[model samples]
Target: MRRQHLAEEIEEIFRCSGGTYGSPKVFIELVRRGRRVSVNTVAKVMAELRPAGRKVRRRRSLTRPGRRPAPRISSAGTSPPRNRNSSGQAT
Candidate 1:
């Protein structure tokens, strides 16, 4: 009777939402239509219908590997001429 009619209306709303409308959205829509239905009731009906929602796809990484490694620089000072000796000792 009343329950069956409500179930049909819920199904219609679910379809109209591209099958992405879960119980919460359906409950809001039913309320907006002046229907005095509870969210739990809508959720129960939706469970019975089992409409499939859209799945979220994972994003791929944008960074790529470089062919050559970067050159390492000394951290002691800037790129000015060094005052050290050729024997690996400071002058």
Candidate 2:
């Protein structure tokens, strides 16, 4: 049996959270409020109405060392000692 206008009320819940609502949580909340909604339906709504402020991280390409050492900003200041010191200790 259709509740006739449950989607509208549920939609408000999703909107109130700024579109960050997921189906399972929404389902639980609806159940708490004595409203019945299929989890699958909620998931479908989220897939259709994805919220804002969501981001995915992109994978980075691997780097290979060339004949020369890589130029890193970590050594920007404090020049190496004039002596060819392998150990940090001064001779």
lDDT for each residue of candidate 1 in 1-91, tens digit (9 for 90 to 100): 9889999999899889998877888899999999999999988887887875566579876666575557887678666666888888867
Q: After superposing candidate 2 on the true structure, give the runs of residues whose Cα lies further than 4 Å from its correct spot.
A: 1-4, 45-91
Instruction: State the lDDT at 89 in candidate 1.
Output: 82
Model 2, 1-91: lDDT tens digits are 3543556656777777676666777777788889767888766665666533234469775765565675766766678856646876667
Please list all clashing residue pairs in model 1, or write none if there are none: none
Candidate 2 whole-model C-alpha lDDT, 0 to 1 = 0.66
- 57 in model 2: Cα distance from truth in Å? 8.4
Could you tell me how far off, in angstroms, the CA of residue 30 lies in candidate 2 after the best superposition?
A: 0.7
Window of ten residues with lowest summed lDDT in model 2: 47-56
Q: Please state the error at residue 63 of candidate 2 in Å.
A: 16
